[model samples]
Target: MTETFPASRLWRDIPDLLFPRQCEGCGVDLAGNGTLFCWDCLAALPYLKPPFCARCGDFVAGDVPGDFVCASCARRAPAFDLARSAFRFDGALAEAVRRLKYRAGVWIAPGLGAFLAETWRAVPEALRGRVDFVTPVPLAPERSRERGYNQAGLLAGALARRLRLPCRGVLRRTRGTKTQTKLSAQERRQNVRGAFAVRAPYRAGNRLWSRWFPPVEGKRILLVDDVITTGATVDECARALKAAGAEAVYALSVARGNG
Candidate 1:
């Protein structure tokens, strides 16, 4: 008699066996490559390095005295206390983000999360221990329904798992806002204002999280997102967190728009 495997098990293994593993960035079969990114393509991604702006983590082209903010950030202050980005939103990184956000490439989260964890190691140590909780900027219920899932939430969940930190849905979108695309910088900022609110005294897991985080009053939060354009969305979320007595809020993203 020949041994037989369960039908379900065989079906489950088919995709992995036949498709093999491919580099997420380049779509090349990564069999024995031992990486989700091809060497050349990985080198091409715009990985942000140090000597970046102290406030927004944007690359600073010219030397500036002291811990200075970027020209754009200095001209118009970002609402979040601090911001860090893993990659510049261009080239292969941008394409990967678009695929993940718009094309249902949800499987890309783990790779992106790993990149974020590696990038985050360069963050100032003072801020690392201060982070008490992790929250992703929420999408409006209607938009989330249309998209089937919030990309930011997926990234946040993966990041939280890697960081061994608690992740929660604390901010809720109160209104549907216009897409930021094709909007002026000022208009984009105005559009997202007052669009988000924190659920009062955030509750999760059937328990009251009254004193779970302690820095300002309740918690110091690290907000995660797939990408940040004008920092408007994150700013609004930060305002809500602060209003709810969060000590400090830091925004981190996989990519940044045009900076």
Candidate 2:
């Protein structure tokens, strides 16, 4: 008897054998591995654990007996009902997010979106059940033209596929704003206020509207993004969504940073 391998299998394996996929974090050869991250890198991920804020997902250092909202959230509650993230914005996760956002590394979106999907499963069913659709935080027209893609949109599409939910681009940036990296939390909030608007779906004489641009009115939405720093962008987005008649909006992101 002679051993046999399928032609399709051989064809698929040849490329991997010739030039194995490399780990995105450490550049380790992944000849047969299916995932993007190696075991060590995945294990070292800075996962956000308990004792985080109830409203926003900021990591709290010390132990707390009961529910707590961060100072920023308490000062002025965000428009979104809740926000959560998969990991703290540090270590390799931070680097991955930066690469996706600034370096046009869209390849990493699916992996990061998987993290968001896993984190979403831990959300209470009461809230998760209410989510009727998923949408991304929109990028400005200028930035989208320069980047050629919206990283948040990529993440949202990946997540929606995993969760079997409809993904739509329902919001648009009203205008371009300065980068929020250097701004204080207060300034960040002010900068993005009124910066987003919901795009009204065209009802007549459009075939794509029913499939791709369904009305969000009276529907619950899940907003996906690459990271949540000050919660300003998502809050503004939520405000616009609600103003457009969305019943509820909950936010999820790959990483969260202390604001």
> Candidate 2, residues 67-124: lDDT per residue as tens digits?
8888888888888988999999888888888877876566678788888999999987
Overall lDDT per candidate, in order of appearance: 0.76, 0.84
Name the candidate that leads on lDDT: 2
Q: TM-scores across all candidates?
A: 0.83, 0.89
lDDT by residue for model 1 (138-236), tens? 987877776677889988887888888888777889999987877887898789888988765534553546443223347778899898877878888
RMSD of each: 7.1, 8.1
Q: Which 10-residue span in candidate 1 carries the lowest summed lDDT?
A: 1-10
Flag regions of model 1 displaced more than 4 Å: 1-20, 32-34, 63-66, 202-217
lDDT of 1: 0.76
CA deviation > 4 Å runs, candidate 2: 1-20
- The local lDDT score (0 to 100) that residue 136 gets in candidate 2 is 98
- Which candidate's TM-score is highest? 2
* Clash number for candidate 1: 2
